[model samples]
Target: MKLGFIGTGKITAAVVQGLCTSGIDGLSIAVSPRNEATSSFLAQHFSNVRRMHSNQQVLDHADIVCIAVRPDQAAHVLSQLRFREDHIVVSFVSFLTCHELVRAVAPARQSCRAIPLPSVIHHTCPIPVFPAIGPVMDLFSTIGQPVTVDNETQLHALWTLTGLISPFYDLLGSLSDWTVSHGVRPDTASQFTADLFQSLAHAARQSDPIAFDALAHHAATPNGMNEQAAHEILASGAHQAYRQACDRLVQRFPILDE
Candidate 1:
């Protein structure tokens, strides 16, 4: 199958690298020339990839087209391209909705919203949120686990979760920096924090299904250091600040209706 990416940015490059390494047969990709460095890099590094002169060229050559532009640029960029009813258009732009895209590319057979992080490049599995489409489900299944959403609201919730990633990384970085200040080497502190978090995440995933609060309680004993620290942070408004940040995301990207 032929796949074309409309925007050759970081996320697009990651997806292209992931697909290239996946060794999926007969898969060829054409990316737009907007991000020349990344597009050229992919073309040079991947035998099956090519850098296209324009976004329209990508749509012209591929069976599956991924609209990888930012939400702000989506309307303007999509206004210039044309698509057929049979083409599959998967958009990674967060604020754009299926209905809006359908209107942008009238008569397209299938259109879905997908939110993929750079992790897809390592075949670590992308969290895909589709509005119940079989072809999209089949395509993303090859890269990672596919999640289907019943409505656009749920999809927006998924997007909100995506927004949390950067803040989460910042929190981790702050903790790692504190360790470095306490005398550990910078690299060692970051690595230790990452490894410890990875193990904790793995354990949480494998453990019996239970409320996260229960696990937190088990991990933090009564009047212990962990509990004391947790209480102090909560008292310092850290937890509330995180909640407010999430609320702000929801407000910024209001839920799209079905």
Candidate 2:
């Protein structure tokens, strides 16, 4: 299968890198010239990857077309390209609804919206795709766990959770700084912080049936440091603040009704 990407940004780079190393056979990946560094890097490093001079060149040769442009640039970029009925259009534009994508890529009967994070580069992360397309699902699953949702509203809700990634990093950074202030070496503190969460995340993934609250409670003993910290954080409304932030982000991406 031939794959084409319209915007060669971070997410595009990650997905391309994932696919190139995913062991998927007979795949030729073409990327836009928008991000020269990323495009050149992929083309130079991957034998199956090519850097296209223009967006149209990608569409002209690819069976599957991926739209990864910025939200603001989506209209102008997509308006210039023409899609065929056989093209499978997958959009990574967070704010672009399925309705808008169908209109933008008219005559392309197949289209879906997807959210892939940087973890995709490491073949780790949840890829939430709306209105599941078989080939697309197969492709994403090779790199990450793909969750298919038929409802656009629910898909938008999942996308809202992806927004928490930055806040998650901030929490890790703050904890690392706390450790560093206590005389720990910078590299040691950073490694500990990352490894600690990685182990926790791995446990969560392995124990699929376990409730998150149960795990949280399991980590805290009565009158323990974990319990005290959890109590203080709850008292400060930190969890509620995170929920409010998610609500605000959900409002930013509205899905149109059919």
Q: In candidate 1, what are the lDDT values of residues 134-163, reduced to their tens digit?
A: 867777766777787787787777777777
> Which regions of candidate 2 are displaced past 4 Å?
none
Tell me, by TM-score, which candidate is best: 2
Alpha carbon lDDT at 69, candidate 2: 94
Model 2 TM-score (2 dp) = 0.97
Q: Candidate 2 residues 1-258, lDDT tens each? A: 899999999999999999999999999999999899989999999999999999999998899999999999999999999899999999999999998999999999999999989999899879999889999999999899999787899899899998898999999999999999999999999999999999998898788696889899998999999999999999999999999999899999865685
* Displacement of the residue 8 alpha carbon in candidate 1, Å: 0.6
Q: Clashing pairs in model 1? A: none
Q: What's the residue-level lDDT of 251 in candidate 2?
A: 94
Cα lDDT listed for each candidate: 0.84, 0.93
